[model samples]
Target: MTDPADGQAGSDGGHIDSFDDLDIAPRVRQAIADVGYESPSPIQAATIPPLMAGRDVVGLAQTGTGKTAAFAVPILSRIDPTARHPQALVLAPTRELALQVAEAFGRYSSHMPEVRVLPIYGGQSYGVQLAGLRRGAQVIVGTPGRVIDHLDKGTLDISQLDHLVLDEADEMLTMGFAEDVERILAETPDSKQVALFSATMPSAIRRLAQRYLHDPQEITVKAKTATAQNITQRYLQVSHQRKLDALTRFLEVETFDAMIVFVRTKSATEELAEKLRSRGFSAVAINGDMAQAQRERTINQLKNGQIDILVATDVAARGLDVDRISHVVNYDIPHDTESYVHRIGRTGRAGRSGNALLFVSPRERHLLRAIERATRSTLTEIGLPSVEDVNAQRVARFADSITENLGSDHLDTFRQLVENYARDKDVAMADIAAALALETRDGGFLMAPDPPEGERGERRERSPRRSSGGQFATYRIAVGRKHKVSPGAIVGAIANEGGLTRGDFGNISIRDDFSLVELPENLDNETLSSLRHTKIGRNPIDIKKDHGPPRTRGGAKRGGGHGRDGYGKRSDSWGKRSNPRVAGRGRG
Candidate 1:
């Protein structure tokens, strides 16, 4: 059930290169081929073997590191598709992730038509879930709350469950689902094989593993970066909604022979390609979902100059070597820094100079910093292309076109026709030429209005800060003086786990039973959820929006009501008294 080399995830070992090197079912292998995946990611290569061997595994990996397929492929090999009940159960933190994992299982089991994978989560009708259950599912992927609800209702049974997976385990614990997860674990049979995957390992998650899992094989995948020195790296911080406008503007201003725009999802590749085409750019998409023949054809078109822009996902772009590529644009920032290095490496091949541009959102600055630190090269901050810059390029292109066509035989005929028209209409020849130029521009003016001043250099549309004269929202956490909690520990835990910077937090007031802290208003549900269950020194913060002054509902020490602490506490010097276990490494 466990390996002798337990708790040695940080240790390095030999890595597998291809899926064929690992033990997998024939049908599953065929599915992988159909998906166009030739090689296994580092996490997949390291995780698949131990999983197929039926050993408990604790995988330390990020969200976009191909961890889903890492477990799905091998689990499908062990699954008995003929069985009517659930043989494998996966617990995810959110419904979106639950659906994604279920889709992954279905994709890997495509060759095995008998296998049925079902996703059960909240926000769906109970009737649908019951119907899916009656139809018989070999694999069930659901959120912890819904899974527990099904267990209590006796509608789902896992007494004979053979495989269990906790996807984003740290996220589930941070969302305050610890008790629900334990309840589900208690109902499962002891013989079941468990696999836990988390971006970070906090003490709370480590304790959960220690109590429940057998000697598990701990596998840690660190972000490794290798970049070419000839490549020029730059970044522009913009919001998500403004990325397209920014991308198109860059395409107009930047001179690129051929370019690749990398996005995260397969659907995004197609979606972005369509948008770029609509904007008068020749673009195409390639993803794992595309057929091999179609993918090859698309690549050929890129190499043959049929298309100058290719929008692609990470997996589909692997092993892509195009000498003509002069630019690479990260339209969507990757979740891992290794991906950043790989994406930009597509260009600057064969010792040619290349340019790499990254688009970072306000919330994603941390990832940008991580990439910089890993690559040991600072990305130059760049501003958006001004309207004047775009107009200058357009004018130069118009002039070049005129020069190239001046000597053509066909141009003589057009010149004579234009002269006759000018004589017939008695109009100035210069006016005629200007009218023709307007028509050549598709009836759009060559010069456009300038954007608002400072729009070009606006890096981040920052949220109103609590330290400044801005609105604030008070939140209370369960940990306080009684838990030996410190402000630094609280800030470090929340900032590290919630992806918030030090500036995001405000004043801190530690009470006997609880502590109240002021934060910026309008925090997203996901961030709040993560901060709510984040722990400080072995205790869950249990953070919630404080409606009014925090008052003791039950017995505790005196001075129960929360008072106005103002924004007096410094965000830094949170004191070295911070607990080491409270902080977790940011996913690369």
Candidate 2:
């Protein structure tokens, strides 16, 4: 391999001027042209040349700076697709990201057609992944934990691995999977080409890179501006259950040419987009599952202003350079600072100011702080939208539409109909207009009352605390210490099942055969019924009263031998008890 310099400098300091300029295969250039990527990102520009030349690379780039293709193009170009052994291994911090990298490999290798890609993660069954490995997947993308599990089981064969990519290396370290990563890397061939990409190079990550990577080229991509300085960053500290409502309110009130809403999961992208469409917004979901053609159409719609909002996962929003996007709403706060930065970076582009709104549940406050520190930018606190704000925006939109369309030739018929209605109802024009305006508003005229002050805060506070006392009801679940069920699982299950606020539940104890959970005493029958049907792990709870038998009025069990601690025959237990009434009766 030749140490050739490509003129392309990607944002992350990689070179990608020309595929021919580097030592990559001719097929890679064809594939790159097919994908319509004329130039490489800085990370890609700098990393690809060194990687193709068999030199290890340490790249520092944020999530959306085209890092996957950087390593992927080089690895795929060098690997023998017919070998059918794992030649390239990419480790990601998350299952979703692992899957995303796998998909990118598949896309870039569409021309190759023989290169096989596999994604392994915790949620997937191990047996299936093992079978895939047996059949031969040339490239493997996996999380450290699952990959380690496979390695320990002897199901994964990395002995022939020629190239290794540690994507999000910093995140894996933070998640405490550093040891597993080290073990996995140890299994690779000694002559393997290693490339480590991270958003931030902490001391641990730097040390790991120094120990593992050979004389590697260092590349870094810094934000050109401080988190889109023109974009106003704000967050609504609402509970998860209330995020949809809050999002809807903001969509109605905020004016924008177009908006991109980032969600964490593919399911969330579709679900939220569906809800927004039902609420009469022109919205569509963009995810990895969508074909390139469909994704292009969606982006076209967004650019042409046909779709007012786009609900998308991080992967789908990559390489999006739409100038009309006036807002980027983090429907779900990203899992890491890198993802947060990428999500907000969609807006405030092309010298135009933009708006970024993040929806943060109280549990994710730590993430908020992390993002702030990483970006060196402050996120302003924004309260949930009031009914008045929604109403005012609705009215303003209605008035604008009327003003724009009232002079059109088509409005004569509607004008006549409105005049007829005014005459028939004996109402003035202003009253008629007011009635029409009220009817046109989406959430009906009356708004649900703002929840009591401090109620949401109290619920947030109760999220981590366990409940105690008979003041709360106890539920028995079959899974106990054996299933690794803990207080957190119990709490999460109940919260998800009952749709009850965290404050409504309390302490949980896991016994050998079952677990006891304390729920609020005033839980309505509907909530209790829902809880009973809610499944935790594979067991549905038998939600009932607590342990112990019935007690008498004197607070003594019916068949109890004695109330005293160890009085042999209940000797003088009641008679010797120091009580004013008993003493008086004895004297009499």
Candidate 3:
């Protein structure tokens, strides 16, 4: 049965301060809370209610303004999670982006739990793709080539699909994927509700939208700068593996009433929150997949000082307003300046002086620059907190706690108990107090010896294999043209997962079955382990050490980021973006 939540689409064109103002399902509302969004982005506020009313939307907005959720929320609220069979399909220009959109859908449907969102791209094995299709996923996000491939294989049936999204349509035509896109659209039922979102609508895209989208409401969002002048921005360059430890260390030394630590994925919010809770910190997780009731409770807890730390993702943290939020930490750097601006804006509200600390890996320095340019302010580079710093702060804070308790009447009860126990056991009063102090520090875990000085960035180690030229071993990834892979995608995944500089790469040889790439020869075990689990096009690289010199299959030279036209595209312009933090679901 079609969900009645879709019937709530009639509640359009109203000013809303919160997600609850929309006439959507309770669970969908709850999922919004889980996401922890500060509030609706401009585009979301303008387009969502009409879309909820089942109206076709023609949106002219830049990416990174939260456009994904604008359509995702209304669509998800209407879909029957149990009767899953490709009820919605979102098309992107490249395979890399198809996966990101699919991840977004998966996050949105987390509240439903049973709803399936599958990503199909060419580089992935047909067997694996077929398995997901057979399982009856409700939403399918894919690139033009792979979506056509699935259609030709009769592995995808869109007769049941009620919604279709052409995300970044101008880029699709620019990349010459127009024919493939049209084919997919033709296969869909004409009764489907279509949404065409493009940053710049060329005549080609406009024509495509004219034919496919039926009497759509024209929603245009003018690019507007959103900034918080009161925010003091700072960044720290820490390796991916050490980010969590670095964050905990800073929390120990920094002063704040409330804090929001932003991560990239939904699972990360929960994982980081759990880790913080284990360390005796008050924390909670907020993401797009949580129930409305649970999300409300979490917000209430934060408001009441029951939890001081909120671990969140971009979508979940939208429209969240809390006066006590004195600090915002970008645990994962945002890919777009709009998201970065919005992230740090969570604090420093209402003329308050609040500062945001961003964590940057060596490879993500470009993102740091992008934020600086967008905000028109230089971010001071800060060093990670040393073990000595953390321990000293802990000692001072513990001492203050003891001093506060000295005059408290509550100590009167424990005093007599300690005296009675010490007398019966013939133990010294100081010895009994020591036992209590041991328990006071939670089994002395917090008082453990700090990380070693070498690991504390105190000394540079001279390794036998460390290379200055970066002429390290060449590794191969099993994704190329057949997988609809782009060079930028390869660079993005490697630099991110390997925690190496994005520019550190040497020659890249992308083959039909695999690609050869040169990187620093002496990678640590942690990076190598991360590379093994990492997927280039959702396909594992099976990273072999390549004990011998680099060899190319068929002697194919490494390629640049070019589409079908063979124009050498810049890395920044790879997919609907000339820069990493510029392109996304919305504009700045």
TM-score each candidate: 0.67, 0.67, 0.60
Poorest stretch of ten by lDDT in candidate 2: 579-588
> lDDT values of the candidates?
0.76, 0.72, 0.72
RMSD of 3: 9.6
Candidates sorted by TM-score, best first: 2, 1, 3
lDDT of 1 by residue, 1-588 (tens): 011101111222336767789899999999888867777777778888999999999988765466788789889999998899988999987665676688778878899999989988754556888888999998999877668667867999989899999998987776556776888889889999999999899999999899889999998875446478999999999876678888988999998999999986665788999999987899999986788799889889999999999999776786688999999999988766767877898899899999999999787788899989877999999998877888899888888988989978899799899999999999999999889888866766454775564874463345443421135777888987777666655664565445443335666667677777676577778768756655554577788988654345673323422442333222222211242222222110
Per-residue lDDT of candidate 3, residues 75-112 (tens digit): 89888877968999998765545665776676667788
Model 3 scores worst on lDDT over the 10 consecutive residues at: 1-10
Off by over 4 Å in 2: 1-20, 36-42, 56-66, 125-135, 148-156, 176-179, 182-187, 197-225, 228-242, 360-385, 399-443, 446-588
Q: For model 1, what is the error of residue 559's alpha carbon versus the real structure, in angstroms, after optimal superposition?
A: 21
**Residue 566 accuracy (lDDT) in model 3:** 19
| TM-score: model 3 vs. ground truth | 0.60
lDDT of 2 at 89: 95
Instruction: Point out where model 3 deviates above 4 Å.
Output: 1-60, 64-89, 92-150, 153-164, 169-195, 200-220, 349-353, 386-388, 416-432, 442-508, 516-588
How far is 578's C-alpha from truth in model 2 (Å)? 45
